[model samples]
Target: MHELIVSPFLDGYLALRPGHQAGLRLPEHRYRELQAAARTEVPLPTWFAEIAQETWGLDIDGGSARSTLLVREPSDHGFSRASWEINLGCNFACKHCYLGLKEFSGLPWDDKVRLLDIMQAVGVVWFQITGGEPTIDKHFQDAYRYAYSLGMMLTISTNASRLWQKSLLEMFEECPAYRLVVSVYGATEESFDGLTQRRGAWKSFKKGVDAAREAKLPVRLNLIVTEDSADEVDAMVALAERWELDHHVYTNMTPTIYGGPESLLAQSSKHLRERTPFQGCNAGHTFFHADPHGKVSICKVGRDDQIDLMAEGAEGLRKLGGIADKLMLRTGGCQGCQLSGSCLVCRPLAKQFQEAKAPLANYCQHGQQK
Candidate 1:
């Protein structure tokens, strides 16, 4: 018989079969006692015990049940979702783009398919396809079709400019993406072109959005807020409302992973001032990010630390487990800081400070308060 254990942070439950690692989601409120029980090798609370038996069909009282609960560690290559940046080439060059003027030597078409296979093999069900513009990839259709055939639930983050193309729209109509996230730069031509620095981009974007709606595709909008586009925030939201599409607004921005100076200039001071608790990042654990060149990392902002997925493949995932574990463990100036409740600094960005890179003016609030 297999044993069940709760995650140390109570984020989820882990099932320990002899050779396989599976995760189970449980209510957040029950995490404390469940984590304690799993650590001490004691019986689960009555509620979880019943849930395990009924939902997963596991016999809790079998003679082979292990005395010690096997808690799944972060280094254990177990994850259910991932974001793949197909390529770093975008048509529009937004000033506030996090990846500032970066270039990537993308993998060959065959390698892209292989990476998709590895993602499926690793139990990644929810696959998000993102890029400078995913639809612009030369082999975008081939890769999208292959992943769709594998029965993966796919979502795409795109600018929506090329979505109106016949070939791409046909593919979406056939495979039907789980969601289409259209990034809205501005509500009008002047505001849009001002941020993107591309002539006629606003017209192209609106055309693509209209085409997606006509195709009956699942679509949402991401209203990107920057100092240059702040005046258009209300108009952007109204645009989404007119289209009857759900929308989210992103205000905060960060510098490039390599610490580029251009990014510092683009960031908004007011947006960075908003404070939030250090609720811990889930990157490299529950989720992972892969760039165009097959370099995998915990997340885009923390891309400085990475593994070459092409050279190492799944083994690279195992190596990432240790890095993620260390990242989650609070150390250095962050240790025992009372302002942790309001501090926005995370481990990956904190690493930037230790390496003597200039800190974001907003992140300096921590030191200022101390």
Candidate 2:
């Protein structure tokens, strides 16, 4: 099994290992040498081996290193990261989920591999696998293995419902992920199960958490503070500390991806915080998100003008730049709003709130009365 990967990063090259945080920054010449070693019978440079051992305890001087150590061909595709919804299916019935329907559908295995190939071809380096809950996807393991094989660093966002499964844990043990980010709904079973609308969810979540901890897997928690779980926010944070895992607090809930206001009802009015000003981002130019069917969009928040990766392949991404530009323009609802310069929400997000017909105070500054 390969212990290290060399790939083009944002405007540079990085030598990294799966599941490990430390990395070696490679100059262009060093990256080229690794590429050459991969192509020919040349042995890995002593410097590379020493650094690999120092950083990850991996000995690359072994003869197989030339072949096993992945060295990706360079691409100037201008895209470095993407998040894919393995499937919209979930084992849990979290009420606040932004995917309104939570349909359990996705591309067949062959098509899923094709989509991953297209993503790898376009130099997607950092890949995130998500879902209504992703672990349950039939092809998730195969797709995850394939992405890692193609030198993509993977991050998996899930509810920690399936981490206790032996097969999944073994796969993660063999091919580690960049990180497994689990969502923390509540500190108590009554609050958690009630919020997920599922009985016995807290037990399953606790099992998954224990399994992950036992395996020493890198995990982070997202404390989801909705009205049901609002009172236990501190306890939720303590739970993360108890596990000695990193945690992030999420209080602001947005409308569903389909622009439905159902998810907003779960929002805790007391925990609403002012969003940082929109300073813009490289949504399409350098980052994108893919649906289970391989349709690519600029980002999750703005899903218009999707490009079909299956039908059009890597070349399909060309349209994303233009689509991103169009989506970011201060038109539509904010066409001429004098307050838009400091408006917290982006134009696309504002459009969703408008479609949901949410309260005047929900998304607008005037709603501060709530």
lDDT per residue, candidate 2, 1-370, as tens digits? Answer: 6778898888999998989988888999999888888877677788888888788887766555467578877776778899999999898888788889999999998899898888888888899999989988888888888998888889999889889999989999999999999998999999999899989999999999999999999898999999999899999999999889999999988899899999999999899887767778899999999998889999998999999888988988988999999998888767788878877788788888888888756666756654
lDDT of 1 by residue, 81-183 (tens): 8898888888898887767664545889989989988776665656799888888888788998887665456789999998888988888877667788899
lDDT of 1 at 91: 88
lDDT computed for candidate 1: 0.71
Give the TM-score (vs. native) of candidate 2: 0.97
Which number leads on TM-score? 2
Clashing pairs in 1: none
Provide TM-scores for the models. 0.74, 0.97
Relative to the unseen true structure, what is the C-alpha lDDT of residue 205 in candidate 2, on a scale of 0 to 100?
95
